[model samples]
Target: MNEQEESNKKQKTSNESTEFLNFDYEFPLDAANVIPPENSSIPEDLFTFVTDINDIAPEPPLEIVTRINSQRQQQQRQRQQQQNKPIVPPNQGVYTIIVGGKPFRLSWESLKSDGPSNFFIEYFKKKKTRVMQIDRDPDIFELIVRHLRGYYIRSTDDIQNQSLLYDATYFGLNRLKKLLQEYSYLNVGGRVFRLPWTLFQKDGTHNFFTGPLMHSLLSPHTEEGNSPPIYIDRDPDIFADIVNHLRGYTIHIRDEMHRKNLLKDAQYYVLRQLSDKLLTAQQTVAGFGEGSNAEVLLLLQDVRIVNMLPPKVTNLSIPNMLISQDWSLTQIQYKRVKDGTPHTLLVQVSDLCMQIHKSAATVKLMYEMNHADIKKMNSMANMAKATRGVNMEIYIDKYCAITIDDNQVKSIEYCMENDLIDTNWEACTKCDLEDCQMSRLILQRAICGVHLVDNMITLCALRLEAISSRFRLNLKREFLSG
Candidate 1:
């Protein structure tokens, strides 16, 4: 009731109004829950019940819902795109081609894109099968696959090239065929000889291209390229002549060296017909000045008769006896002997004096005596006269004759008496020796008769000796006597 109490109440009211103006203002929970003027400064303990609660759920914002709707539209559009897309087969990426009963996996896109592989692509498209069967060798297919993959094929083996050609033709792979056709070019000693395959179709027997030479050139084992050409270890000129012959060109080799080299190549490559032709040509050329009637007298020392035939003979004449020194027939004289006989002789003689003389009719001398053997016989006769105290003389005349019919000897008649052997002895002492001489002469006549009919005759000297022994006389005694 006093003035001082009134003043204090007024002062308190002014301080409270100043504090209300300075504090941050927040909207009331409701108009009824307003703070009372009496309790303007609320106690911190009274608001302890208003603690934060994290468990209560709240509705999503409108912006979040709009974004979720946009995401749903995007998903729907993606699904539509998936449904509208073209259906691709599971095996479309890869193709399985069966060759030689084996599966070969390849890219479908690559097969379809390749020009040569169109046939396979069309076939695969026509048949929707997963596996396509093809009848082809697996090894060849491997090569084809390599070629398809853009690898350069450099195989030069003839067999492999032939196989590849067959496959290429079947598959319509013109590129591979062209490559094979191009292989006919031969690289002989840095010289490029382009020989077409068709050029060798003539006379398949003599054609080097059609025969083993072609096989060697195209052999797959041989590496082929521009840097390292297919090497031929032969004379280039000789090979050129061979190529010319293969190309249906008449090969007239004027150079003897070239001919000799060519002959060697021909023999090596098994070009038998070509070898024969070359030999005949060489023989004709070598015997040009020599008369046609001039006989080829082959005095064979250690040479085989068969080895002296055409091709071998040609080789012999080249570069001065290319075959062997023992086969030298140039030293033998080819002149008609004593009588005016119209016969050219080919005699094969050895130191044993067994003469194989071939003329119009073959005359083979089974037993012949040289001057030394005659002297030996004469000495033996002289020794017999001195030691045995028996005067014995034996002489062999030069001229003798025998008759032959078929392969068997019909008769042996000497041109003169004791033409082969002449002996002077008593009837009883010379009986055995005379019988042996007669038997030996008959055997010699038989051998000559057999040789007359047949070019070759096999006569055993042991059998003749046995026959002579059966006559109660040894063949050695007969030889000593004459």
Candidate 2:
């Protein structure tokens, strides 16, 4: 119906042989033949054509058809590629996780704990049985301390081994342990696992964190007064996991506390040897009202503080009789006062005995001491300073005059003046040492003795480890029998 159609109609009419006076001398070809074709090499070309676009709607562009077919092929290929790709697996629960093109690390545990706290307690009991087999390998404690320091301290910080670590272990016994334990405070598994990771070591190996930092519990009680027994919430997984984690001791935070505890306890023993009296609470919670509501009370917080930064300097208080009985050493106690009032603290111990003992005394006194002699004692006097106090320098002197610094000589003379003879100090005269051995002294004790003998702590027989082991063995035997 358009102009093109009208033009085509006119063309058709013009080509047809019609009876009309169209034009004079016009060359008209035959209706059936536009071109002369025999074999028709150009048959298609010979025909003058009138064609439509598509069969369905008159005709369509050749390019459009090709484009549609190509699109369909691309979609098919996309499906095939998806099917060919393989999937990657996932790593289980740990510190790290990844998902949806993003990577993340996760370390979490269920806080809502249920069940008898004793189950974990009992499990801890069972796990401690392993300690019985560990012999007194003094090297282990050093390794443990190194391991702990590796994690606990940075080079930027000067970590006081006695102040931060052993102090917590000897807390109630020496009070420092309790002070340190305050920092060990942690919230675990909903149950408020009130543990003294810093102050008390679980059964003495070096694994402090893995050890039961504290039993997740409140004080024992019942709803009614006359009831024989009572109960609280209960779920086994939390207690079980608690048990499992603690029982399977590791050299992580848990075990580190444990070793620190052993050392702390040993430190206390050293104090006791020095004739220090340990203060004990009456356990009657009159001030706190009823049943030791003070269960897990910060027992050693008020415990006195001392200047433990020294070479056998004693700030621990002692009873006169105890001192007379064990005169080889002394204890001077100080009340811990915050803003002047006494902080409810009272325990006695030799500060940092383990760390001090761990150092090489001969090297400390002879070779290392020479470093200090660079000026006063001459070049020949080798000295190495003590790690505890920065200003504390030791040096061996050729003249034996200045090297035996009056301050050092004063301390030695003061102890010797009071009959402080330790037969074990290789540095001391045999007569002086024999006299010390004859007297009741700190060296007469365990780790102190080891310090004098081999320069190490023999923690194999620490009391807490024995107690925990005993508790565990008893529980296991009871469980088996039941």
Candidate 3:
């Protein structure tokens, strides 16, 4: 197809989209509601119940809305606004518009759907372009934009109005300049400013480098003083969405880490038990029972923790690669005693990593001990700076001991026998884990399994953050000095 033909085809599609969505919009009078508090990230154990591919749920519903337009009395005379404001940028419109294939509207709505459109109309009066393309519906855009303006004002007013927070300009939207002038969010020096969807794309997909008015918007998570959910005017529903998404991601990662932890622990239990079993077999060889040498020989064929993932993932078998003279009779004897794999497979434990290995056996590490190892490993993790956080096992095992310094190792292995009820190890509730992690580990007894999960999750978060270039830079000086 030629250029004009392709243009005609594209226009036909655009026209169809516009025709499908156009509708009358009511102008709202009231300001938008300030957002609710931010939510925590997703949990790790959320997908534990799911076992097969059939267990996965379906996709969520997508919002399909219409643009809305309404006429209302002016809030202020148009001439008064023209004198104070700068000329509107070429990229923006005084009223709603369609620029570069995306919808861009400037309408407002009150708490109710049909309310006054006065402030919205007046606000758009002094701008350069005042085009609003007709679409299937106009109400949705008006309402959504009205809410966006309100959020922009609420989140940015402090910085815009020259409060002590003026330096904290990492969250405001860049297109609407008046928000900062009238409200508190400043227009300049904002690090992470969100742009309209229309500006965020070229061919279609969001442009990472050039789309955002400010670079930080694309990288908001690490931006300093970015109270993101607060600034983004996060819906409580979005938190739920985030939790859902995070659970999928975290579960995959957490389950992997946890499985390794559990398997290692399970394997350790199996091996240790098998070691005991081996000791029994050895005693049989030394002791002279009916199956004496036979029992010892039989055990060489027994499956141990060191040999597998688990019954859930896989069931391991004695490798043909391993065999011996005593082992041959042992295999035959073990097969004689059991119909399936040995139960000693789950008895391996970490405390006996050496004993089982030297006995021509293998051991899996304990999860509890592994958690301690992760804490220690993370402390020794390659980092550009020093950091501390709550350790989960320490929380369950030692009451959420805070690591005051890099050398704070005693907290992880604190004796449950001695430390429970010890007044020194408890984490305070106020810090929300953050404050609790920075303080000294006061030994106390308040061990809980859920707290163990939370502490370990907190540990993962800390490990991630400790090496995070952002966190490392923020805490580097102290880390270096110590």
Candidate 4:
């Protein structure tokens, strides 16, 4: 070899050795098969015929095998931990509750904060478990859940309202019960009706259940089960018409008698708007005869008589009187006043007259009382209490009107403000106290009668021509306004 060639060969070998030292090395999974060097003489032909890599490969070291097994075991343990991990993390305040066979995943924080310390909170406090089970109607429970989320339940359906109310009661959610306002069931007569309180409230007729009746309906009963229905003492058939009217449904009026009965029912329930509607309907179809004289249809006969006691009027029993086909008394209550004064008596009668007049606009009521009238009233009452049999002096008035002489009705004082009977007369022998001073009052303006069959009497226009004219005038006014 020349000097320059040998120097190049040495430089090449040095560069290769440097590269091998700088290279990154890692152990391979399969060891490469190596043939024996030229100096080894025993394995040349054997390696030439050997094709399988496993035959030439050496057995792995025990340390490597042990490390591989340990790695597999660690991997298996990690998989088991993943499989056993909880669905809801323990740190998060979340839980799953099954209600009525349906699962609900809800946050404990939401249930605690949103609800008003009610059943949900109380239940969780008592049972501190991650999962809970409650056997209740899921459909109704969904409503309760929404309610807890502060959603206003706008369900106007009477049945749905009743269900929600029942659930709220069952869950001991008082606030939820109040949120569903004015929903109730009424057992009116023998028939049961589901109705909303808003029906009455909407028409501004909530006064129908103002006093004791409303109290009874609202007061809670501790007895287990569904809420008791409110009972109303009224004819179901007639009340059905009222229900229809309130629900904005049209009711077919059969005839004058039907209309009259409906009006009476409306007045009894204090449905002023309904009464007005009935009156308007009647006026629209009213007819009159050719002249002022028309046959009168007397409504009530054989009315039980009640004499109004003088001075301290303990009780003013207003009887159920049907004066004409169009006017009748549906409800009347007489409150006895302990104040034995004529003024108090006058106030009560005035109130009764006003209430009746407000009920039906077609009828007019006027009362008269004087010193002689007071004596006559007391004497009649005394006679009624004393005698069990029929009294000859006590007479029952018929349907026809009776004319009074001028001498009998001396001077008639007209008091405009009082609106009741003129109670400004001198004291009588029976009523000698200062408060028992009697006055003269003329009850009827067009006709006068001593015995009117009952304690109270209502008078309307005697002539049909007058009624027809009045009705026509009202129609004209309404039409013009419209």
Highest TM-score scorer? 4
lDDT of 2 by residue, 350-457 (tens): 211111011121221111223422232221111112222222212112112110111223232234445433323333232323322221112111111000001111
Candidate 2 Cα lDDT to native:
0.27
Clash count of each predicted structure = 8, 61, 48, 5
lDDT of each: 0.46, 0.27, 0.29, 0.47
Give the TM-scores of the predictions, in the order they appear. 0.29, 0.17, 0.16, 0.37
Candidate 1 per-residue lDDT, tens place, 1-482, comes to 99999999999988766666455445755553345566466556766766556434567899999999999999999999887664444434777889999888877655643463556666765565758888889988888777776778754554465677667766767677777776565656666666566655543444555666556544433334212234566667777777678676888777857666777787665555566455432111113375443333222221122222221121112111012332323221122222222222232222342222212322222355567544443443242222222111111112212221112221122321333322221222323333222223323221110011011111112011112222332433454454
Which stretch of 10 consecutive residues in model 4 shows the poorest summed lDDT?
344-353
Runs of candidate 2 with Cα error greater than 4 angstroms are 1-71, 75-207, 210-282, 285-482
* Cα-lDDT of candidate 4: 0.47
Residue 74 of model 3 has an lDDT of 36
Full-model lDDT, candidate 1: 0.46
Backbone steric clashes in candidate 3, count: 48
Poorest lDDT segment (10 consecutive residues) of candidate 2: 444-453
Best candidate (score: lDDT): 4
| Residue 349 alpha-carbon offset, candidate 1, angstroms | 13
Error of 3 at 362 (Å): 30
> Cα deviation of 474 in candidate 3 (Å)?
58
After superposition, the stretches of candidate 1 with alpha carbons farther than 4 Å from their true spots are 1-172, 203-229, 281-482
